[model samples]
Target: MILGHTIKDYKRENLLHDVITGIIIMAVSIPISMGYSQIAGLPAVYGLYGSVFPIILFALFSTSPQFIFGVDAAPAALVGSALLGMNIQSGSKEALAVVPVITFFVALWLLAFYLMHAGKLVNYISAPVMGGFITGICSTIILMQVPKLMGGTAGTGELLELLEHIEKTAEQINLPSLILGILSLVVLLAAKKIMPKFPMAVVMMAAGAVLTQVLPMKEWGIKTLDAVAPGLPKWSFPNLMLIPMDEVVTISLSVAVVIMAETLLAENNFAQKNGYRINDNQELLAFAVGNLVAALTGCCPINGSVSRTAMGEQYQGKTQLMSIVAGLSMILLLLFGTGFIGYLPVPVLTAIVISALLGATEFELAVKLWKVSRTECFIFWGAFIGVLLLGTINGVLIGIILSFAEMVIRSSKPASCFLGIQPGHKHFRDLAESRQIHEIEGVLIYRFSSNLFFANAGVLQQDIEQELERRGNIKAVILDASGIGSMDITAADRIEILYKSLKEQGIRFYITEHIADLNEQMRKLGIGYLIEEGCVRRTIYIALKDMGIKRPYPLEGGVDNEERSASRKRVDNRMQEFVWAFGSDTEDQIERQIAQQIKQLKQNGDVEKLLHGSWSHMEAFDEDEWLEHLEEHLKEIVNISGKDERTLAARFEEHRREIHERIMKEHPELAQRFKERRHRLDEHLKERRPEVYDLVVSLRELEKRKDME
Candidate 1:
């Protein structure tokens, strides 16, 4: 689908640039593919064969527009080891014949994986594990090339065996070859730093060819690639009768998995960087076709090459057209330019392979892993060490096992915190971080910061019990379930037990902010009926209100203490008039009249003055009946005054002076009584309920500002 889409949106303007980029990638791919063919235990010519048809096939079918599939070191080394274990000699006719059979099976496995839609299996390999695996492969590749770098035969086996072989052959090292390899390494590194955009690998290979032809280095014990077969690859089926089907299938499965993981990682990284999307299943199918084509042409298995993909990206590869051009260029080289490749020194190719592998090592990622998570750092080291001591496939397996164990450990001991209401805000924050925040008087707000599952059920219970013990006076508990994305049956059962236990202790238990999916989970698990009626709320505020507890505020408002007292006295005089006029027989009627007058005053746009005049009247009533009625009337006034507090406060202050003057002139005799009553009320508020006094003052100021607006 992506190939069809790319062709549909093809642009004539990008053709020249794409063609140039293709040629550049072609030049860079030639020598590297040759060296990797040796790594795959095949002749250098087969490497050229692997690159040509494989590149064309993948480019033609791939969903990722920029990715270039070709011979890569990891899968090559894996196939080489599998063949070597079977006692197949490297670079021999028998080994060459067997490679295509192995590759064809690998292709079949990839096709099977595509059919299964198994692309998401890559998610199981965490970043640290993948980094460690690549780092280990880089070390293995560099060590394997050490013998070639020193002008001797390449050694095999584990890292220590290879090191010992190099040491045993130290006396036979050729000086000219060593010098040429060192020079090549220097040139490659310098070019990378100074002119990274240029085709450094091609330039170095060409220079190596010229030097070998002009100098007497061959006489001094330097080896050259010699003559490469000059022709296009022939299509032929593998002699499957000669190979063990079961052994080939096992090796093919392993190689297929490694290729899938590495290729998907490279494809996803480049696609994200360039702002494109790739279908994973389509990528798997493309790899299947590429490897099948390579097998038909008698070449090793192929996968996406990170180095070549990055080179194509750096050179501004625009589309699959670049890949097509690259495939054709390889064909051109096979037709006429094979003679030039024959003169290139072996040491130079070794240097190119070593340099590319070195670049693939993620030392910075290792450092970051150490800094962020020590357990993940251990996983990286486990894989890295396993590869060095064992082999590539075994090392990755060890890393995967360790990563799963670490994940289980983390989930079993999830981080949790007690929440306290932050000052001046409704949010319940972790009290450990905000020490100034006060805990609610009889309520506990607890937050569990992980998914609820079997491994953590007991731990969750322990944590809740410990918190309840630490805070002895908590009568209502609100479990903030916002962090819990899902829950298992074990966790739901544990919660049900906790609910029953808290209910027996006379403490109300509630859950807040749980998602709909989690609610459905609880119901299916039979824990929903265990929770008390009205115990589930959408937010902390709603939960607190259901428990009959009001939120706390700081003892600060726009009105000063003296101004608030003056306003209270004016309201007290009005309440005294109502009390005297109604007497004891009509107390209920008097309360209704007062409420109606307050409502009327609010509608007449005099809310600020009315609220100021009513403040002391509300306080003068008895606490149970009269205060409840007054609070109901005040709530109505708050709704009428609008929800914005600042505007209300501003309007209240503007009308304050006028209300005080009018009250003083109309009731001079009652003024002294009002002042005394206000003094007593202020003392009572300051001594017993400072927060309530501040809240009442704030509400009046807010009402006043609304009236003025």
Candidate 2:
């Protein structure tokens, strides 16, 4: 037991607060425990019986500071469903006889779980599957309880049976019971919103008990609970030989798995929030011990209670002593205060159970998944509908299968992107993220952001082939293997095939920026020639050096466009980058700025004094870089303003004259850069479209001829 270790730092002054918190938890648990007991196919009092010894035992063994174990809804509903499948009646002699055996098996399964250290398996059950499975169980239980409000017994089993029960019970509608039930639900839901921390269920149960005694509710068709027989329950072993071993095993394993997944998730969350760690395997042992005691005491299965734990935490309950006090408090209630339970109205209790289950349902998670991924939302709905139409076990199986299938699909086509240089940063980045980033002139750098396995090998081949086809004259292809942690036979075979295919097409293939383990894996997979032939490199810089490509590596490629010379490719890339950022609508976006800069130039009679960034139309750290981009877009700006080519040529001449005078007089160092920018744009346009280039040039020639005349 971890009890001594848990209370090692126990303060003498903390006793009173733990006692008070325990009392409040007992107050809240009375109606809830009774409701879940009914759900477990036992009479209302067994819920209290389940709460006491089991909780005290769990507190003794648990590492958690504030997790509560009791007869909770999920396991109770599962047991109740088991009863229906076996044709056992609810709250009857046969059900009471068979249920303890189920609890015995649940404990046995939990022991096996602890022994095998199977708690780690909970990590594999995704959130949508757990949320949907639990919500489905709660919804099923809600439908079971709905008949109580209409003056009928709580119906059990799947959706069709419950719907049929409601239809059959429609003839037995008691006006007083229905009205009381609706009013009780109103108060319960209202209290949940208004004072969520208060124990409103105890107050409502007290009111129902008083009303049943004072008014002739029995005469009015309002059912009341049978009075609980008090004092501690006698301890005895469950006669598991009564039920078939296979049936019991199936039901018990399902219940144990549900308890571990749902309860551990919630408990671990509380532990993390409170800055503590829980031992998963030890927690499994605690559950086994708690449930073993529950079975010996003739109670149904027990589980971690989120509601009770929240109340304990809210009341500032510290250490496992809080669970001890809560258990002891329930023991007192069983000894002295079982009288009022007989007068408690059935609909009122039904309302309390329904209210709690409603709160427990993960409706918000469904909404969130809907907005995030419809496929995941489908999984949520699949589990929910499977529970309602099929059963809990099948519902959970369907959810797990769907989750696994989705995971496989995601792995089959992982994220891959083309890498490019951003100039200021030495390393490359994804080109799709920014317009400023550019690819190398004759190299394709593709990054696959996951391990290369059979499922995604085909995706890698397809992405590379498509890029190569779009980029015509690629001399080399570089695979950025930084994201790849490992490779499989299928992926290695595919890589070898791709290397041979590209070699046939006269393109060299290289893999770079990967750990040495990758090369070792490649060698083991029979592709060691890549390492020997200098095709596998430790970094992109080394790969470029091997390819005779150097730094400021040509970020100008006609590969995605068409084959072109170096100068044409460079000028074309510059224009393409500019148009990508500030496109055809650049005239509208920076219209005022351009006009102001032009007016400032005409007013001052000097282009050097013009405001910067007015024509660049983007945030710029390099004035020369953006100015070169502007020279390419002068044709578009002139055409958009409805100016003739003659007028545009004259405007271009004025800017050229300003640049020459400014570069020669003040910035003599930049004379060569300014001279390079002078005709590079015209050269790109003339090569791309000869007629328009000739028309613009002829207008300049006519001006020169007139000056000669």
Candidate 3:
């Protein structure tokens, strides 16, 4: 029952890797932590304090081994915004006193959430909403740092106010500070783009420290981190009397939600990448303890750092040992390195902070969502705008509300399409795609592409009724339940009403391709008897056959000789068009080449290996048309040999192996390149045709093993 039990099976080599990774992470965390602390309205050094004990606590108790908990921007920004709204000044005794109180209350809220089994609350907030909120936070953080970057005090308020403050302070900007800040920003951005693996923030900070020492920074009116206190942070408890209890509770609850959502996302992402799992409840407990410790130590609230976790993974960190190393390294910095850090220019740190925040903004995701689902795009923008105008807590609230609204609207208006048989295909397709599709003279096939729930049950009925009215001669209606994975009572009732109405009109109603559970639900709801006997069929083809409807052919096979002849004539016309479009000369060459290869296969008694090689060489011809012709020729061979379709299919598979082996032997270099190209194609296909891509990949892997043998 111990959390992060994977640590028990750790190897020495993994330990060594983790030790080095831990050290690297510590190097990165220190300056970033200080920057985040400034965002949290605390002295820059409090960032380091937050990173230390909270990280150790999280590492000890968290279920996720790879997740690096620290002073992340979102929570710190939220805390700072809330405090600023309450008129508390950043880096003041009042702000310092209030932060720990808020941190303590956040810890309590997390503990409450843990007890209530609220780990799944993160699921309620959709990806688009989270992306928009983070983007907004990034914008806010960047704007807040502009004044600091210009050698002025950090601004307070929302996006507009911050922008206004910057404009008002434009005349007071320090030239030297501005130049150094811009230079630091350039260095950080370039490092990120050109050498992502390098610790650009640390490098820039070091460079700034060296520059500050060599240059007369004080005389030039350039601000530097001159007051950094030496030695490690001492233990201190939250002074609850310093802030109103109601204000503390409200801010704590808001901060806790953001922390939980962000941390869980990071944990799940890393766990999935590493082929492991983390218990969500245990993660909550870990953060709760970590935050509690942060409160006790008078530090900012902590959350999982996605960037830091990625760094750990990049360095091959194996366990929580990396976090421990990071914490100890921060300790070393506090005890021995504060003197060097004190010489670091404030403008350089501001640039690091701005660059980091800007990087966190997800413009790409917003654009992608815009392309795929406009509603999700709206949700993202709404959340982002809310954060900018209304502040973090209210922005997130608005986003959550909008997300749920969008979900409801989508479910209430599901996509229902009338299906018709495509000209050269056996299965039914959406009627909208092709006007040439054949609709059965007295039948209608309808498909609803969503779960049949209470919200959309009436919509389903209306769509079916509309389709029935449009298809005037419909004697039978088949509901393609392949896409309807589940149904609620209201949907079931609506379906029953539709069936009764259709039956009254002398139209036969049938359901096909639904799971057994749906049928069971129907039976339990007293509508089972209506579909039990001949009313429900396993497939659309079976339903048509049972209704004595013969499939039209030349399209698929099995037809009367007269119909077959007409179909063949139509098929011949279509084939001529395809051949002409592809150039008849090229088609003829490909046909002759395949014929000659098959003939050679027959002579060598290896006919089973005929179609196994790369079809890329025959790219001059249309692949589908060529494959159809090849199949027909193969069928002729099967007829002459007295073999069945199943036997032919099995032989073709063997032939595929033979071709693969021959390619590896005679053209090994090309075969390797083909394999690599196929891998890239497989990755591309995953988004377009996941099932087909998976099957193809498995088959290719099997062929690869055969080639190896």
lDDT measured at residue 87 in model 2 versus the true structure, 0 to 100: 91
Best by lDDT: 2
TM-score of 1: 0.72
Off by over 4 Å in 1: 1-32, 35-42, 81-97, 155-157, 239-244, 269-277, 310-322, 422-425, 433-436, 531-535, 550-709
Candidate topping TM-score: 1
Expressed as tens digits, the lDDT of each residue in 326-354 for candidate 2 is 89988988899787567879888888777
lDDT of 3 by residue, 9-46 (tens): 76678777677777767756655677678889899888
Angstrom error of the Cα, residue 167, model 3: value is: 2.2
Weakest 10 consecutive residues, lDDT, candidate 1? 554-563
| Candidate 3 collision pairs | 608-655, 609-655, 612-656
Candidate 3 residue spans exceeding 4 A from truth: 1-45, 61-67, 72-101, 236-248, 265-280, 305-322, 370-373, 401-441, 523-709
Question: Please, what are the lDDT tens digits per residue for candidate 1 over residues 481-548?
Answer: 88898889888889988888999999988787666566556657887443214465555665666566
Q: Per-candidate TM vs. native?
A: 0.72, 0.70, 0.66
* Residue 98, model 1: Cα distance from true site in angstroms: 3.7
